[model samples]
Target: LIGARLSGGGGMVSVAAGVERVGVLLEGFEGVEIAAVNGPRSVVVAGEQQALDGLVGVCEGEGVRVRRIPVDYASHTVQVEEIEEELRSALAGITPRAGRVPFYSTVTGAPVDTATLDAGYWYRNLRHTVRFEEATRALAAAGHRVFVEVSSHPVLVPGVEETVEACGVGSSVVTGTLRRHEDGPGRFVEALARLHVRGVGVDWAALLGRGSGWPVDLPTYAFQRRRFWLESGRGAGDPSVLGLAGVDHPLLGARADIPATSGVLFTSRWSLWSQPWLADHSAAGVTLVPGTAFVDLVVRAGDEVGCGLLSELVIEAPLVIPEQGGVQVRVSLSETDDSGQRTVQVHSRAEDAGPGADWSRHVSGRLAPEAAHADFELTQWPPAGAVLVEEAAERAYQDMAETGYGYGPAFRGLSRAWTRGDEVFAELALPEEAGKPDGFGVHPALIDACFHAGVFRSSDAERQLVMPFAWNDVRLFAIGATALRVHLTYQGTDTVALRLADATGAPVASVGSVVARPVGTEQLRSSSDVSGGRMFRVVWDRLSVRSVEVGSGFVRVGSV
Candidate 1:
C-alpha cells in the first residue's frame, strides 16, 4: 500500500479552492484530510485506500483533474490513528531534550521547545494534519529568511516559497540541497554557491580540509577550460569520422556486426595469461570455465538485443581452457522477432584452430524482454512459514567438496538457508576478499552460491548429489549484487525455479527454472581435461643426432 495516491472530493471540482475549502468539503468522509498545501491552488488530500478510491471517482465525475501522489502511508489523517499506540510504544524509551537551534513543529503549526517531544506528542504528530504552510510562515515571521530543503529533491521547496509569499515575506529565499535526476555533487556545490551568494557564512576551510587557519586563493570555477578566443589555422577534425567501436567486456572483445541478420556477435579469446581467474576455477588440475560463466555470456548477449531474459541455455559441452593457448569465444545473438525475443548461443574453439575445426557449442538459449518481477515479498527479513535448513547451513559445502567442487574462498558465499515444503529461502554473499567483478550482472561466485543451496536434499530425494546443467527464463532486474536473499521453489526432483533479491530484499534477478543433473566426481574430472597441447618427448632412434651440422657453410653432400 506504499506509494499510493489519494484525491479530494465533496466540493466544486475546479472552483479554485485551498486547504480550508477542501477540508470543509470532506466533512462526511472518514480518515481523510488535506495533507499539504503546496501553493494557493496546489493542495494534496490524504486518506485511507478505500476512501481515496471513492473520492477519486467523485472528483473525476465533477471534472477535477484528480491524481494520486506516490506515498506509502495515509499520514496526517484519521487513518494514522490506527498506528498511534504502536508509534507511542516505539518512542516510549526516548527522552526529549532542549537543543540550541529553535525547533519548528509542523503538527502544532508553530515553534516548540524540544522538551515537549514526548511519546504522546509523537503519536499526535502522526495522527494530525501537516501544517507545512503554517510552519513555513511562522519561520519567515521569526526572521528566518533562508529555507533550505534538506532532501535529494525539492519536493517541499515550492510549498515553502508559497508559504513565505502568503505571509508577505517577499524577500525570503528558498533553496534545496540537491535537484532530482541531477549530478549529486554538482547540485550540492550549486546549492552551496546559492547560499554563499545569499550571505550565508560557510566553513570553506573545513570543507577544503585546511586545518592551519591560513587564507588561500580559491578558484571561482572548479574546472579549468581551454579558451578558444583566438582563431586557429588548424582545421577541425570531421565529426563523422569516428573510430572503431569497442566493448570493454572481459569475455567479449570488440563488438562485431552479424553479416546476415540484425544481430551482433561479441568475440574474444581467453587464456591463463589473460584471465588468471580461470585457473582458480578448475577441477582435477584441469582448467574449465564454470557453468555460471556461460550464463553471464548469454545474459550479456541478451542485453545487446534488449532481451536479457535468458529462457533456456543447455550446456552441451564443456569449454576447457588449454595449458599453453586460449579458447576463442563467441557470444552471438540473433535478430529479435516481433515479440522482442531472440536466440542466443555461446560457441568456442581452440584459438589457433582453422575454419575446418568444429566449434563446441557450450550453451544456447532464448532471450526476451525482462519478465514480470518475481512474486516474492522480501520486506520481512526472513519470510515467515519457512524453517531454517540446519543441515544445509552446516554441511552443504562439505557435501559439494566431496563431489569435486573444491570451492575456493571466493565461491563459498552460502551463508544461511531455510526451507518449507518444496520452497527454499537462502541468504548468500561473497566474502569481502572476493569483492565484485566489473561488467557482470551477478558474479559467478554469487550465482554458484545459489546452486550450493540446492544441495539440500529433502526426505523425498533419492539422488545424493546434483549440479546445475541448464537454466531457463532467466531475467535480471538489478545487477551486481554481492549479497542476495534467494527464494527457490523445487519444480521437480531435479529442477527448481528461483527468485533472488538484494540483502534488503529488493528483487535482483529471477530464474524461471534451473535443471540439475546427477553428477559424479569422475564426470567433472573428465570434462575438465586439457586436450590439445603436446606434452610427450618422441625418440627418433640413432638418426636424430647423426644429422647435426654446426655451420651454415656446411652444405649437405651425399650421404652422411
Candidate 2:
C-alpha cells in the first residue's frame, strides 16, 4: 500500500493521559482527532503535522508526557475519507465469514455479526476510531485470562496489560509471539517459556507429537524471590572501631547502646542515590518512604531485642524524602518492661540540618518477646459467595492517580481484587522491573499493596490522604515472599485484620488488627525539606492592540 498509494501528509502522537484530556487539548484544532483510546492512561491522536506539533508542545509544557508515532498518514480520522471509496472498490470481491473460532471486532469493541464484514464495513473500520481498549476489556470480563498477540511483534502487550489491570481481572497473563529483529527459534522458545512459567494451559502434544503432560505442583521454594529491604550502607566506615556495632541494612548504618538507660539505638541514613527505589512510593506529588517500611523497621528491631513479635506500630508522620541531599533515621529502643516489652520510637532528620534541627518522630511501637495466638487463613479460594468489586477494580488505578497516590512500576503490584461480607481480597506480585532485593521477612511494596483493594471499602466522603496509623499483634510466618494473596477483614471504622500468604496458600504474615488515620499535608512538609512546585500561575496580562492589524487597505478614506 505504501509503495503504490498515497501516504497522507499527516502525523500521529500518543499522550499519557485520559481521552477526555486529549479531546480538550485538541478542541481548537479541528484537523486533529482522537484515533484510539488504548487504555485508561493512554490515548493516540492523529491529524495534520502542524496540529500535532502544537499539541506536543502544549502537553510537554503542562507536564503531560506525549510521543509522536512516527507516521505520515492520519489514521482513523477524517483524512481517511479521502481513500474510502478506493478502499471499498479494492475489497469489493472479498467476503468475511465467521471463523471456526469466533471473531471479535475492535471496530465495535465486541463480537460482531459475520455478515456485516463486507467491503463497506472494511472501509468504515479504516476510517473510524479503534476500540482496542474496550475490546480487550470485554474479553477479560468474559473470563478470558490468557492472551497471545500472534503478530510479527509485541505491539499491544503493554496496552493489554494496562487494560487488564484496569479491569481488575483475576490473574491474567499476556505474551507475544515474535519480535522485530529476533524472530528466530530461540525467541519462539523463550515466548513459550514465558507462558509456561505463568501456568498457562498449553497443548504440548501438538508440538511434541506425543501425549500431553499433566500439571504438577512446584516444589517448595522452587521459585526464587529477590531480597528488597535492609541493604548495606554506602560510604560509611566500620562502626566497630568507634565502640558501635555495625548494622548491615540498606537504610541503617550502625547501632549503639544507651548506657544511661540500658537501651539500644539504631542509626541509618537515606538519600535518592542510596535508595532510589524510595522514589517509586510517591503520594500527592511527594516521595515518602511507604508505611510498610516503618513496619519492617519495627520487625527488624524486634529481632535484635529477642522480641521478634510486633505487638503494635503506629505511624506518627510520613518520612518524606527531599529532592536533594539525604535524611538520617534513628530507631531507639527503651529498656524492657515487666512484660518483656520494649518501647520503640523511629525518628528522622535531614543530614545537612542546622545545629538547632530536631529529630522528628515518625513512628512509635512496642516489641514483645512473645505474641498471643492469632491465625488468618485462605484455605478456600475466593471465600464462597464473594462478589467481584467490578467498579472498584476497574477504577482502582485511575482513582489512585486522582487522589495523588500515584503508583510507579515498583508499587504497581496489584493485579485483581474482590470483596465479600466485611472482607476484601486481592492478588499481588513483585513486578519483574521492581528491582527489589531479597532477604526481607516481608517486602514493603508487597505488603503495602495489600491496602490497594481497600479503595472500594471506603465511601467517597471518607476518602483522603491517609496512612497506616496502628497495627496490633502483627506476625510473620515466612520470609522473602515475592508473590502474595492478601485478605483484609474490616473490624470497624478505618480498621481491618490483615492476612497474607504465598501463591500456594502457605502462610506468610498476619495482623490481629490494623488502624488507619489521615494526616495533614503541612505536617508531612514539616518532616522533610521536599516541597511542591507551582507549575503555572495566574498571568492576567493587559489586553493590548494586536501587533498585526486584521484588515488590509488601511487607508483612512472615510475620516479624511
Candidate 3:
C-alpha cells in the first residue's frame, strides 16, 4: 500500500477503516490507539492501510460512507472515547506552562493555552466543527502578507483564494506541492526564491522535506522578423481620368474645368459679402443711411486710431440736431492724388443751396481720417430757474416710498440739516410715532433707513454724497420710546463717522469707519479668477445684516 506517484508535487496520505480490528488480530486482541485529534468533528487514526481499508469496507456495507483520510493515523474514536474520563483525570494531574508561539484550538476559532493542549481538549475537538475558514480569515485580517498551503497536489490553493476573497482579506496565497512532479522539488525551490525576493520568505525545506533533489536549469530563447516592399509604375492617360472613378489621387490635374470668374460667382452667393465696399461701388459715393454707412465709417476710423479709445463715442440713442430736422448721412473722403495730409469735416448748414437773405452756419472742427468720430450734446436753451430744495426732497421721498422699504411723507419729519463750510449740521422734529425718548436710543434697522434718506436729501443740497462702507463698534443704549435723532460727519471721501442720538443730543449708537469708492452693479457682479487671471460673474442672492463685527469688511448675510 506504500507507493509514490509523480503528479504536481506535494503528498496525500489516506487511512482506511477497520484499524481497531487489525490491531486486535496483530497483538492478540489488544485495544486500538488514537494518535492525533485534529479538529472537533474529525480525528486522525494511525494504523496499517490494509486494516484501514477493511474498516472502510465494513462501514460502506453498513450504508455509511467511510472516507479514507489523507493521513497515516487512526485518531480519536469510540475505542479512545471509552477512556476519555480517565484521559481527563490524567490531564488534571499535570500543571501546564506558557509558551512563546501561540497554539490554536481547532474546536474554537481562537488561540488556546499551550498547557491546555491535552486529552480533554482533544476529546472535545473530535465532535466540533473544524473552523479552518475562521482561523485563516483572522490570520489574514491581522496583516499576514503571505499564506503557504503545505500539502500534496494543487487543491488547497484554489480554496485559499476563494476564502480570502470571501473575507475581503488582502494577501497572496501560494501552495507548495513537494513530491508530485519529477521536477516538483526544483519548481518549489524556485517559487520559494521568488517569494523571498518579493519579501515573503517562505520555508520550503521545512514544509516539503530537504531530501527532494534539484534538476538542471534550462534556458529558453525566441526571435521574430518583419519586412515590407513597394513598387511604382506609369499609365498612359491623364491622371485626372482617375477622378472619374470618384477616387482621390495626388497626381490628378491641377486646373478645374470651369472658368475662375464663373467659379467665384457660384461661391460668392454663400460667402460673407463686404457691404461697405459694395455700397461704395454701387452708389459711387457715401450713402445717406446712418446705420448702414455712418456707423461702419465710424468703426473703421476708430480701428485706425485705436479700439478702446473710440468705444465710448458709439451712442446708443439717435442723434438730434438743434434747429433743423435730423438727417442721417455717411460722409467719406473723395479719392485724390495729393500726398499732403487732408481733413474730412462734418458740419451743419442752415441755408438752402439757393440764395438766402440771412444764413446761420456752423462748421465742425476738422479732424484726420483716423479721428473721425466725436460726441456732441446739443442744447436749445438754458433753464429758466432751479428747483427748490423742498421740491427735490419731495421727489426723493416719493421715489423711495414707491420702491418699498416702508418710507412715507410722515417719516420725513425725522431730521433736516445743512452745512456752510467745513461743518455739517441738521436738526428736525422726530415723528411722534417714531418712539423718541428723553435720552438717546435707536433701532438698528430704523437708523440705517434714516441714514439712507438723509444721504439722498443732503446729496441734492451740497452735491456731495455718502455711500455705505462698514459699520463698527455699534452699541444700543437707553431705548427710545418717542423719537431718535442722527449726527453725521466725514473727513474727505476716505472716512465717515456717524452717531444716532436723542433730540436732547445724548449719544445712542455710532459707526466710526472708512468708505471705499461706490461700486456699480457691474463691478459687484464680477470677480477675478486668480488662477486663470480672468473675470467671471459671481452670482448671489438676497443679503441682510448678520452681526456688526470690529473688522475692515462689510457684514452681509446670505445663503450660498
Highest-scoring model, TM-score: 2
Q: Which stretches of candidate 2 lie over 4 Å from their true place?
A: 1-234, 260-262, 354-356, 371-374, 391-394, 530-560
Instruction: Indicate the residue-level lDDT of 117 in model 1.
Output: 91
What's model 3's TM-score?
0.24
Cand. 1 Cα-lDDT:
0.69
* Arranged by TM-score, best first: 2, 1, 3
lDDT of 1 by residue, 166-223 (tens): 7886686788998766699878887888888888877765655443434566878887
RMSD of each: 19.2, 20.4, 41.0
lDDT of 1 at 450: 83
- Tens digits of lDDT, candidate 2, 336-375: 9988889999998866555566778889989999843436
Candidate 3 error regions (>4 Å): 1-80, 83-96, 151-155, 181-188, 202-560
lDDT of 3 by residue, 1-560 (tens): 11221122212122222334323323421223343322222233434456555554543344222344554433333333445666577556666678897665556767778777665676566434345545666666766657676665554454455556666665464555453543777767755775777777566557644432422234565546463422112233553575322112111112232233211000000000211212111011111112112222332332222321211121222122212112212222222124322222222221121233222211111122222221211120011121112333355545544433234322444344433343333434444333332322332224433343344433433432223433332333335424445445666644455555554456544444424233232322221111111233222244565645334433334432
Q: Order of candidates by lDDT, top first? A: 2, 1, 3
lDDT: the better of candidates 1 and 2: 2
Give the TM-score of each candidate. 0.50, 0.55, 0.24
Residue 473, candidate 2: Cα error in Å is: 1.2
Which ten residues in a row are the worst by lDDT in model 2? 551-560
